[model samples]
Target: MTSRVLYLFGSAAPPVHDIAAVVRTAQNRGFTVCLGLTPTATDWLDPQRTELERLTGYPVRSRYKRPGTADVWPKADVIAFAPATFNSINAWALGITQNFVVGVVAEGIGKGIPMVTMPCVNAAYAAHPQLDRSIETLRGAGIRVLYGEGGFVPNAPGQGRPPAYPWHLLLDAAEQAASTP
Candidate 1:
């Protein structure tokens, strides 16, 4: 069976332009990519959601279903939070499951699934006291939080973009995590 990669997107800079490449890269790696978008991310991706679904052969979800609604997607083999924003990072770390993506992350932790998170916040935001603790907490829980070289490094706040964020790094990390014992 094909491994399912559940990609959770937050409102971060790279995703605004690089999401298609990310999806294609995951598919190339032999994953069935399912997208879970944060509300803000969904708003940003609304124009292309249809195209994205076409590319991945699955729907892009941002909200929870109504009561009695059936889940239409496959169970995730590996879950990745890409372009993980400061808000999303904090929310997930704090156990705040107010949104679909965050809720999935919270549940993924309990499910004992291999998971990876690639944060895309800038230097100033990354410097927040909560961010370090959050990353530490996540790492402590067996979540692979990819940062620094080969992943994301904080750019100066307001500098308007860091050196091209390594979107591919997320795919590699997720695959590795999924395959590990």
Candidate 2:
């Protein structure tokens, strides 16, 4: 069976290259990618969104407005938010779904869907009191937060590479989660 993967992008911290790599790798593994981007991320990546849509064959969205009043949104098998910003993380943990990405995440969480959030905020923001609480809340709500090798950071100088065997690790985790009875 094909797995539907939702790629939620926050700001520029996590690096567009990382997001694109993950999406491409997931696609090669028979997973369909649906991109949900934040306005800041859109600004940072600009035309890359179009390239992503072409690669995934699905429309990319950065707003909360529905496609059509009567149209139903597509449900995803797995929701993965990469480079989640501090604002988005806090909003999501607090049940704020004003945007399309957060809305889908809130709905998915309520439905007991598996979610993986890779936050890419600077060190100071990650250390903030509210941010820590938000991260804890996300964890408390059963969301998987993938911490990169070095740890969470608000802004890294360059696009850091995922650990070796990143795709395999993600695939294994997804498979294990799917196998739960």
Q: In candidate 1, how many Å is residue 89 off?
A: 0.5
TM-score for each of the candidates: 0.92, 0.78
Model 1: per-residue Cα lDDT over 50-167, one tens digit each: 9998998878888887889888787788888888888888889889998998998888899998889988888899878999999888988889999877678888877646347777
Q: Model 1 RMSD to the real structure? A: 1.7
Cα displacement (Å) at residue 72, model 2: 7.7
State each model's C-alpha RMSD to the native: 1.7, 3.6
Each prediction's Cα lDDT score?
Answer: 0.81, 0.66
Q: What is candidate 2's CA lDDT for residue 157?
A: 36
